[model samples]
Target: MTRVFITDDHTMVRRGLRTLLEELSGFTFVGEAGDGATLLAQLHHQQVDLLLLDISMPRLDGYSALVSIKKEWPELKVCVLTMHEEPYFIRKMLQVGADGYLIKNCPREEIVKALETLAEGKQYYPAEVSQLIMQDLVNGTPKVPLTRREKEVLKLLVMEKTTAEIAEDLNLSTHTVDSHRKNMLQKLECKTTVGLIIYALEHGLG
Candidate 1:
């Protein structure tokens, strides 16, 4: 059986994960932790084949925890399950040695697939993540000439920030923000916000 551990701050989220993991075949729920400190401490005494980690935690955030865990337990497989879908976050986690990256909103089957892939000693990047990589490969170099401000807007869009929120944060008028967005769309040949987001991810601009 694959001995898996979970680390999430919320009790309910942990419980839900435990329940779902238990129902899956060939998986043994070894333990869980509410924070990164507890997880690091418990890992010293436990034999975990896989770790399902959340990015936002109370004591220690996922990035720090991942670095420490990878340093100490280099052979351990970590799968990041988080609500963050930004390209930057995804790239950072993979660079930190996470074996898999799955958005929290991904379907339940994807969770099982990720675990199984990890158990088989293979890396798993969800469809969304893979799409970014493929786009980068196909584009070769980012040909579309984008201004600095336009790039910032694209990054914010990839992070799911609304136009008004981005405008306020960037201290730009709403009309100006809209103009930038429209210009980016035209330059990138994208018809929607999602396409712009994909372009940003493809170029690792976010």
Candidate 2:
């Protein structure tokens, strides 16, 4: 059986999900928590195969908690079941290691399907999530217009090169390299290094 845990600030939400998941064969509801901290604490004593997470909670939000959970429990699968449908949140969650992203309004069947997919060690993003990602790509400026130097910097950045290393390799000062990184981030609408890397990989620029 797959042991699943639910973490959300809403008691009703947790109870509702628990009810739905209990009726599904092979899925066992292990526990539930009202916030991220309590959820993390519960993991210390429980064996969980998957975590159904919420983005907003008291004590610690889902974003920070997700990062911590992945760092400490790399084997655990996390599926974000939240109300946030914005492309920015979806990208940010994926960048931070979410195995799946499902809007709170997703059909009950899809939620179970997402959990199943993640439990099998595969990523899952519903059709709505795909549309959001595609919208972001279409609305954002084309990356091909970037200058050669900027593209070089982006490639090195995706390779995990530090600012100093990029500067040395390109024969530029650290300040200049930082400027390039900032510009790339702006042009790509990326808020973090991981986001930039994802963009590069998605566009085959990496």
Worst 10 residues of 2 by lDDT: 136-145
lDDT of 2 by residue, 1-206 (tens): 89999999998999999998889888999999999999989999999999999998999889889999999999999999999886667787877899899888878889888878887889898887777667767886233357799889889998899999999999999999989888777556578989888988998889
Q: Each prediction's Cα lDDT score?
A: 0.88, 0.87
Candidate 1 lDDT over residue span 1-206, tens digit each: 98999999988888988999889899999999988999999999999999999988888889889999999999999999999897767766776798999988888888888999999988899888988767767875346678999998888988899989999989998899899999887566588988999889989998
Question: What's the CA RMSD for each of the models?
Answer: 9.6, 9.2
Candidate 1 residue 97 Cα shift, in angstroms, is: 0.6
TM-scores for every candidate against the unseen true structure: 0.66, 0.65
Compute the lDDT of residue 152 as modeled in candidate 2. 92
Indicate the worst ten consecutive residues by lDDT in candidate 1. 135-144
Error of 1 at 132 (Å): 2.1
RMSD of candidate 2 to the truth, in angstroms, is 9.2
Deviation (Å) of 171 in candidate 1: 12
